[model samples]
Target: MPFVWAPIPFPDTNRIDMALTDKRRNWTPEEDVVLLTQVAADLPFAADKGQVTKSWQSLADKLVACDHFDRVVDGRKVQNMFTALVDEHRKFDMASAKLSGVDQEELEKHTLLDELLPLLDEVKS
Candidate 1:
């Protein structure tokens, strides 16, 4: 089920508190794919403009549109998730690069995260 952000009513008050009532859930693999795809699409724009938050917000909107995630995702959440993914991929890429006999053509990337490495490298250059 998708997470809903309902306002909590204050007792005897006319105000409603707009805080997240449920704990945040982990990103699913499907959601990650959506996010990565969206990021890849926006890479050139982001590289030229350097507006990461706007790019992340666009990614969040695209992910939410996919309706694959359990909870509502915001730009900040998307940014954090992408940051974590990039960090993990960096470590993985470094370890893989250090391997002596592994040919680039022989390396297999079965996940969206793995596929994102080269695109990220492009943005850096």
Candidate 2:
């Protein structure tokens, strides 16, 4: 399920429309602008334009760095790690298939060694 801005209220009739919209899950430039604007407006006079902009940008960056951002420049490193783990799992499954005739204990050991070690290695790499 997509994350919802639970603090914000909406009309009952508009629930379906809001839920079905891509805006519910994805962040966009316009929404970022609006969020910055609203947050800036709430700030005291001591906060200058640069300060507000920087704070807003930082918040946006942190949100994007979170797992939900999916594929993007900021997400490349995490995506690579995720892909490597998946690939390692596939390789382990293939290796296990080749040893199908082995005893159950041996198969279990092979499964763990073939899968987890490579996945951990990639994480360290």
Which candidate ranks first by TM-score, i.e. highest? 1
Per-residue accuracy of model 2 over 28-108 as CA lDDT, tens digit each:
434333333332333221235447445444544554564644323322332333345447557866876898778544343
Candidate 2 global TM-score: 0.25
Per-residue lDDT over 1-125 for candidate 1, one digit per residue giving the tens place of the 0 to 100 score: 99999999657432323233334446666666666777666662344475767767776777777756555788888778777878977787788879878765422222666666677777667
Clashing residue pairs in candidate 2 are none
TM-score for each candidate, following the candidate numbering: 0.59, 0.25
Candidate 2: deviation at residue 66, Å?
9.6
- For model 2, the superposed segments whose C-alpha errors exceed 4 Å read 1-74, 101-125
Evaluated against the true structure, the overall lDDT of model 1 is 0.66
Model 1 scores a TM of 0.59
